[model samples]
Target chain A: MNETLNFSEHRMGKAIVLTLQGRFDAAIALPVKNRIRSLAEDGSRRIVVDLGKVSFVDSSGLGALVAALRYVSKDGGDVRLANMTVKIQQVFTLIRLDKVFKVYPDLESAVDSFEEY
Target chain B: MPGRQLEYSARFGPNLDNLILGADLVARFREETKVNIKTGDQIELAVGEALSNAINHAQAVGDDAIGLTMTVEDGMLTITVDDNGIGFLPDEVPQPNFKEHPSHGYGVFIIYEVMDSVSYDSQNGINTLTMKKRLEE
Candidate 1:
């Protein structure tokens, strides 16, 4: 298994799906935040982050997602999360972030939700 | 016979990359000790937060070494993270308002929520954060 955090992006209808793999923590938070910022600035109003393969996420990772939401919100866009593992879900629930971000069980649902955005 | 006690300890340089190394150590500890995956996940999360906080704080002061120790005994798991950086009062950190959805200040909060109890102390320029969780039989 790839130990380092990595991501890839692809267009799906009006939404941009960014799939993240490996651990998401302080080490890669800045770059991930920057990538999300660039995506929002580049006119992608609807962004979906796929965390299916992400094995871990700490506060720094959550902060990056929150920052992404704030950045896109400024552009009238929204950032959604998809496919969080049970552990990731637990962290989000513990911090009550589950109520802040629109989370979907799968990437397709996340991408599809953008139709209303 | 009394339950076997397990212990592990190590020190790492002040670097964010050590976060991963610390986590891997926890994973190995969990595997060797036969900790349940669910509890192990929480332990890893809490320890990761502690290590991250220490490493970041240590970087600000200087490249100091961070110490980590984990011990399991009597149905309890204890973790202690030590650093040479300036430490703050744990009680002083306000509980993050989930309503505000703030982008920062969630590290300590996460650690507190995951661990059963957390405490902080500083002595002679060394700061230590101790976290504990109850383990299931």
Candidate 2:
């Protein structure tokens, strides 16, 4: 019910790690969108969204994530999702988003996918 | 309204908690009404969408309770979600298309697609969204 979303920057060259917590509902969907927009605007193209801590994601929540993926990739950066739950993962698989988004088992590998970051 | 009526009601939080309870209500109604699987899923998703819409847009606080009611009459299921909060124009709310927008906007769209009938009425501080789905095999 009470989940927190956190943004962390690892100055490991060109990669940014964003950690999402709590529930991703319509209430906070816009905020997530704005955050991703800002990050992409700042030139942090290689982004890895850490969903290991995200507990719930409905259709709206998934929308925000999908939007983030599209926005971040537009400027030569890629977004990868990591540590998704079975319920959330099933949703992605159901909609075939798993194929569209790069999913990783852990943040380390997801971040390391930055072409030598 | 038919000669017979079956009803169930519950109050839940203004967040995702209401969503779970809403699903439960629909399941119970399906079991009692003995509706077909396709009809049951339609009713279940329609009611669920209405409850989610109430909780997401209307309720101000997390603990604020939304009342859900399901009516089965004339071989059809009617669900009503009532919230003691702000109301808006059902016409103004944009329709959600999963192919175009896989987001919260689709809740009402899903309701309309699955339900046989749908309407929203607001008066004296109560928002009532009623949806109906027919029994089919």
The local distance difference test score of each candidate is 0.86, 0.69
Deviation in Å, model 2, residue B101 alpha carbon: 3.6
In candidate 1, list every pair of residues with a backbone clash. Answer: none
For residue A41, model 2's alpha carbon misses the true position, in angstroms, by: 15
Model 2 / residue B83 / CA error / Å: 0.7
Q: What TM-score would chain B receive for each of the candidates shown? A: 0.91, 0.85
Which CAPRI level is candidate 2?
Answer: incorrect
Q: In model 2, which runs have C-alpha deviations exceeding 4 angstroms?
A: A1-58, A61-65, A71-117, B1-4, B60-64, B97-104
lDDT for B73 (candidate 2): 74
Docking class of 1: medium
For residues A1-117, could you state the per-residue lDDT of candidate 1 as single tens digits?
227699989999789999999999988888999999999888888999999999889999989999889989997899999999898999888888878899999988899898877
Candidate 2 lDDT for residue B15: 79
Best by TM-score: 1
lDDT per residue (tens digit) for residues B45-135 in model 2: 5565577678778854435558888776776667788887888778887754445544336556556665678889988777888877766
> Clash number for model 2?
1
Off by over 4 Å in 1: B58-64
